[model samples]
Target chain A: MLTLQFLPYSEIEPLSSNSRIRKILNLVRENKIVLMEGRLKPNEETDLIQRTMENLSKDFKGIELCTVYPNVKDKFLKGLLVNILIGDRTGLTVVGPANIVKEIKRDPNKILLLTENVRRKRKK
Target chain B: MIIRLRDFISNVFYKLFQQRKSLKLGIYGPPNAGKTTLANRICRDWIGEEMGSVSKIPHETRNVQQKEKIKIKHKRKELTFNLIDTPGIATKIDYEDFLKFRLPQKEAKKRAKEATKGVIEAIKWLDGMDAVLVVVDATLNPYSQVNLTIIGNLAARNIPVLVVANKIDIRKANIKKVESAFPQYEVVGISAEKGHNVEEFYESLFRLVK
Candidate 1:
């Protein structure tokens, strides 16, 4: 009898920024609720949102985004005040399937996650 | 006659402003036990909107969702409360499990981190709760470690608890198993999603807060 060998090294793959996005999406897809730390820069956050919206299609249920900032209410000027105070300390959370995060409902940040099929209980 | 008149006025004053003290009623349970659904049902009937979203996924409520000042009126008896929907509790959370949903490596890890933090937040919120509704899925076994831990915490804090046996609409649902598991606390059986027997749930709430 000949011996056979099987090895799986999938978990060892190095993580990247894109892979990070993929991982977060993977969590949402599996119906697992996740809370991500750290915020993308304001420009980066907007870019990500724009890119996601531009890429949306019929196959996705959309993604949810919730951003948190220091609870500061001070604004001295209409447009110039925000530039001084919101100096990159803000953080954001993106939740949804990898394919459809753009389709998330409401403010993505205020959303709570639920697996797609877990919602089968009848409602009144 | 003067003594009786004084007692009557004092009682009326107590009945008006004092009866509506804002009690914070936190809704706690394991995943997908219809906590949010029940909250939404109560709000829609009174507040005209749902509290938060509900879905089939576990931890759909990762944060503590709040809908304040819901006044329940039943047969002229009334109660005012702030309803809080807390994130589902679990013994373990792994990033790899999230990968099963086809998420990539980074996002799954991020979610796992957030979820771990969320669990801590839920536990911390316990101190602020005046009473809690321990929502449980009637279709599953009720003797799990998660349920016991939740009940244990509530007991330790002396917080008033009412066990909600949710999902009675399903054929497999068994409310008695839940009741037997936590015989110390009163259990109310109702389908949060289908809106069946919700009036009974409200009646139980008035009793819990009273």
Candidate 2:
């Protein structure tokens, strides 16, 4: 039942500007759960989350938003990404791509947004 | 056979005696969301005693609070109510301050991490309840993490929710804006301090429970 939607870092502005994004933002404004994906520089992620909260507070009525960070294998990167997703429900788990993992581990609140890989048994 | 029959009769009597229903109702909101205020109101009105403390500081009711059973009669029906007050939902916690709140270090750390977790738990708890009342601050911006999370989760579960817009006595309180924000909800604006609109709230609750 879990749905995954991916948005690359470069497309964030256009995605956010889209009317669909506004509708989703309104859902967040109304205190609904939303999962966002993008490649964000450590600092940019933090600033963007904070700014989004501030704007939502001012413009929306009776809505609240929370962000979750996914924890990948790289502790440092995970920490950085985790920081960006703070102030909301986040999951922690190891994922693919060490560089992305390092960014995610930097932030504390990010949970592993990705599903775990299962190891298949080798035939004797 | 005579002894066995007597024992069975006594057991039936005991079972009848112990059969009492207490409706479980949860009061949830963010820090300073007026959960305690509402708890106090219910206690004073129904039980004739104020059981919970009210404070301006957020997270005053850090621990889950349960009031003594209260009995009220509406439309000739008798009901026993047990109200539970929960900690305010917040995005982040200052670990040091949380520690100073007298929670054991280990427990505080766990709870600190569960700030969002607590909100989720509160939402899940609402699933089995007879009704849920989501309190919002009328004086502050209607939108915030606690308000939305609680409402959204409850709505998703299809639980009957009653929105209480607290602190209406303040000059800046905007009842209309709060209502507009939750257009699909049955929102009632009231000042918990002065007990304004409280009767209507109780009446609405009676309708729901009935």
Candidate 3:
């Protein structure tokens, strides 16, 4: 079964950087897709990827991470200012296990998250 | 007279400043993207030495390697910099993947551990780069998240980047796909192992750091 876990920005706002990464990675390692409410700091994103690499195994492949932030192109300076002032809490970050989420494609308007299908037989 | 004198002195200081600072060019990319091969090509051409070894097995370069004080002279233009070849960055590193390459289980596990450290080191070294050459394998899909993340992080840091579409010697190589994937940056296609188009590659580096 596939599970999507929604993590609100407020839930993780007070956590340390390492703790935030750990929280997200732990959920991902459990095969739960994390729908995070804010973008991670650039360094945090790299660190998350680094941590993910360390914990990879046959059962837990890795993760597919993507973020969609709108209006950055329209209001570049304003967005930059907001980002600097209140952290990068303007976008949604999707992190899913690679085995479950086949792909995550983000365009200007929407995100296409493709997942793998699993089938099983039921006993009568 | 004082205005002219001030301008002249400022120009001398600027020239002196430019001469004193050495460039650090970092080669970065995903696993098996020919980063080390390109580094070896550049080093062999200029310093007459290879920086490190290359292998079909991924994560062969599990550490940050550097070759210092290499100078290249092409035509009348000269460029010199410290070259750093970083291990390939990846979101996943399973020891079982190495088993496919016939590596023993214990050795595979050891490589995986070192590879994770390498990824961390590579990301850490990003802060120190003056310019970076992001090499991509032309034969594979260029739209991977790993590529986007690496490029995005570099862009956020405001680092000057040049995309090198490597493995052009292979029949399946598609430079245009790589170019379109990163339309904002200049994409130069070359086969590092075959030494094809390296002259042009050298010319691009001079322009990149200028």
> What would the TM-score be for candidate 1 when compared with the true structure?
0.57
Instruction: Pick the TM-score winner.
Output: 3
lDDT of 1 by residue, B1-210 (tens): 999999999999887765458788999887788989999998999989989988775666778889878888997998888999988765345566678877788987776666655665677688889999999999987764357557767887789999999999999999988887788899999998899999998899888888
**Interface quality of candidate 2 as DockQ:** 0.05
User: Model 1, range A7-93, lDDT digits (tens) per residue?
Assistant: 112221234445545565455545443355444433333233334333333343334544433433354353345444543223334
- Full ranking by lDDT: 3, 1, 2
Q: Return the TM-score for candidate 3, rounded to 2 decimals.
A: 0.82
Rank the candidate models, highest DockQ first: 3, 2, 1
Q: For candidate 2, lDDT tens digit of each residue in A1-124?
A: 3222333333343443344345444444443334444333322332333334334222231222333344444676766575555522234112122111111221224343322132321231
Candidate closer to the true structure by TM-score (higher is better), 1 or 3 = 3
lDDT of 1 at B174: 90
Q: lDDT (0-100) at residue A39 of candidate 2?
A: 36
Error of 1 at A108 (Å): 41
**Top lDDT: which candidate number?**
3
Q: How many steric clashes between backbone atoms does each model show? A: 37, 37, 0
Native interface contact recovery, model 3: 0.42
- Give stretches of model 3 more than 4 Å off: A13-16, A54-61, A68-72, A75-91, A98-124, B1-21
Candidate number with the higher TM-score (1 or 2): 1
What tens digits encode model 2's per-residue C-alpha lDDT throughout B151-203?
A: 76666666678889999888999988888767888888888878998878887
Error of 1 at B50 (Å): 1.2
Task: Give candidate 2's error at residue B96 in angstroms.
Answer: 7.3
Ten-residue segment with the worst summed lDDT in candidate 2 chain A?
A93-102
